[model samples]
Target: MVMGIQQVSLSADGHRAAVVSLRDGVPSIYLIKNPFERRLVSDTLAPTVWAQRRLRQVPRLAPALALASEALRQRNPFLRDASYTTPPAGPLLAASEPAGSNGTNGHGEAPDSTRYGTLRVDFRNYVFSSAFDEARPPRATPSYYSSDPFAPKDNVDENGRYRPRRYRLYFTPDLVYGAAGYDMLYGVQSVTQMMFSDMLGNHRIWAATNLLVDLRNSDYLIAYSYLPRRTDWTVAVYHVARLLPDYALRTLYRYRHYGLNLSASYPLNKFERFDFGLAYMGVNQTDIGNLARPPVTRTLFYPSITYTRDVSVPGLLAPIGGHRLALQLSGSPGNLLYGRQIRFVTLLADARTYTSFGRGLYSFAFRLAGGASFGPNPQLFYSAGVENWINRRFDSFPIEDLTDFVFATPVLPLRATDINTLKGPYFGLFNAEFRFPLVAALLPGPLPILPLYNLQGTAFLDAGAVWGSPSNRRLNLFRRDEHGRQVLDDLRVAGGLGLRTIILGFPFRFDFAWPFDGRRFLHRRFYFSVGLDF
Candidate 1:
């Protein structure tokens, strides 16, 4: 297994022969005429390379000349003559033609004769790395040469067969330090994350933490994943906590919890996958004001399954085309693992489609999402507000009793309203947004002070509804009627304009909306959130 000639094949015409050689154990092909025989008329050997080399690439003289002319005119006051002040040429493919009607080139007086332009080389290794990086412990290392580098090579192995992938060491793929926070909820938080994986990404390890200003509120997480075969397995553990202040009741609350989780993800194909998870967590909610009182405590065991299909084309600011769908079934069942009183079953579906206007990134996005709960202890759901919103504000209908429901479901982004504006057992939502970029191709990249990217504008509409059994008088969808009974309202709708940008590697979003029903025209709602627009 040397980096030298391995095999050879000859054409029927005895004038030429095809050579199979190895470079660092990888194979390549070369052709030579009259093998094993050489005849040179001159006594001295020729130069190995007589001219500059290029690999299927060429340069033109027009742009360089145009640039030189413009530079000369701009810096010299004597160049005010119309004959010397022509603008530079526009961007175009490379050509040898002269710029701006200059019929003659710098060497116009030279005699018209042909000579070698360059040494056009087809070094296949430059096209791509050696397909074979590993070979059965080679005896020794040897060099190789090729004339027809484009010719394909054969991997007969002296005895015909194939090779397999070999194991590789881990390398760092993600390492970052960034800021994280929402206005009133999490004030000026910071997060750091690191991840390492093998060359093929078949194995990985991740460690992340959010250690805030107050050490008591620190959160830590670590995980390991193995995906060498058909199934991907992940094991994770976390110790996370949060502290909240309430000025109204003159109380400070702390939600201290820890959890361990295991999951397996199996790819059905390239665009679809199945994920199954089992997790356990212990919750502790304490009111600091009354230390003598026992904190609200609960233990839960969760088992879930999800199916997702994503076939989206990535764009600068967002997906330009295709769609994604995710359907999930999850439950916290009593006695399934540990907690005896915990019981709930939840089903959710989320679908999104992004369609661009031809090749231009005039992205039009639409999303539909819904969820439902079953069993006596069904999970609570919330509606309204963006994710990780800052400078938070609430409308006249202030949300109440959100502490118990906040952990039950993720915030459904319903701009024009505050976080947890509505809560219920079931809810559905629809969203549509038209996004266009301002100099998207010319990116707004990172600066020394702040990292920023992907600036785009959006026009959007959001509509959603949340409701449950009329008997549940505590639900936000239930309002007192003339007869003092609970009644449900029609769909809540909002239309708005928005902007999207990424700062500190986070998708920072801003939205302003008005009540689409026209009843609240004067009331304009503004939201600043940290997340991509759905």
Candidate 2:
């Protein structure tokens, strides 16, 4: 059966409902008390339905709402301007100007839009501009300026060139230690030097003083040197007391000299010069036993011309590649000056060359030096050793404990022979060496713990000979001809291998040499020394 409900009503007891309806196309009314009470029940459900719909939409609306809230909080004006569609990606412009301000184009017109310019914001930087000036061109700032308008500055002379400062002081210490056979010598030699230019407030005058002291030998030399700047002339007053080396290895002597010297030098070019000197020297020689020799007071004049040329690549401990040449001519005229007692003339030449094989890793070096004295012999040049020693013992005594000793003269090296075994007025010497890197080249990484690096190996050869002057041929003890003329027989020769490396920025060497000529009856020698090269 189908029924259409026209009206519905709740029962007064709240347990039954009734409906008046037309059923089966008939108008009929019926009432059921408590009908469907247990099976169907209804209550208000609109609020529950609305809450379910809101729960379904929460995920989509939450994030958008949060973003809107943030935008409202920030409220950036740039975002509000629709014309500024693209946000700035970098730093903003620091300055802005009106359309007709000074910051405009060359025609004094502003840009089409509001233009911006960059500005550095450092306190130490300054910007100067002539933008306000319309008629004149801008000026640039200068990098330098003189503090005084009328006086020179920064060591600049009147000619606009730099000159050396007027005052200087320097002090250097030299220490040497060596052992030969059973003899050892060690000492500290210090030199204190002071220089003053523009003496008496005159730029043409200069003065210098050098004082050298040997702590171990009790020897000293003081020299006062004065120079006339315009003329290249120098005058020196000096006093010296020092030992003179005697070729007789078993004996020693001393010399005391005081003198006044006048010298003039002129530079021919960058690498050559001529020097002339006049001196009045008073000399007294004394033996180790305090026995005095006849005194000789002399006034001597000498002139020398020296030419030197050097082209070298410098290295940490030594030069890697280059060559040097020097030639000198010097003469002491015996009777040219009053009270002159000796006369001599000398010519000297020296040449040295260095070659690198592998970009500073390996090198070959050689030196050739020769000198000859003619006329009269005033002083003898001794050869047999390479360097001067502060103390050299005749016997096998310990240098540290020995007290009864005398200062020895400066010894020039002729290497590969015993000390004080040769003396003469003429000499020629040659030296050659091969140097190569050793351990340092083989290692791959740095060694932080040790100061030693760049270990090097060396092989060397040294040869030299000395002879007396023609007038003093009888003093040539080494070799003589049938007519008693001095001969260059029995040339001294030595060959050796060595190790070299730097320690604490200083170069050190150890060498083992064997003499080939045996002129001094010396055997193999091992030497430990300090220096850049041989």
Considering every candidate listed, which one attains the maximal lDDT?
1
lDDT for predicted candidate 1 compared with the true structure: 0.66
Task: Residues 1-534, candidate 1: write the lDDT tens digits.
Answer: 334677889888777898899866778888889875766776653211111011111232222233346666344322212222232222111123233233222223111211123322332234554646555454432222133343324423566664333454757776566545554354566568888887778788988888766645678889999988999999999877777666677888777767899999999999999999998877667888889977776677889999999999888767889999999999877644543476778899999999998585698999999998887676776654777777675432222332242345644567645645665668888889899975443433564455345578999888887666446533353356577754445356788898888765667888888865323343788887777666
Measured over all alpha carbons after superposition, the RMSD of each candidate to the real structure, in angstroms, is: 15.1, 34.5
Candidate 2 lDDT tens digits, 120-199: 33322345766666656645532333544444455576897877754534333222223222122333333334444342
Instruction: Give the whole-model CA lDDT for all candidates, comma-separated.
Output: 0.66, 0.54
The model with the greatest TM-score is 1
**TM per candidate:** 0.62, 0.51
For candidate 2, the C-alpha RMSD (Å) to the true structure equals 34.5
Residue 50 CA displacement from its true place in model 2, Å:
65
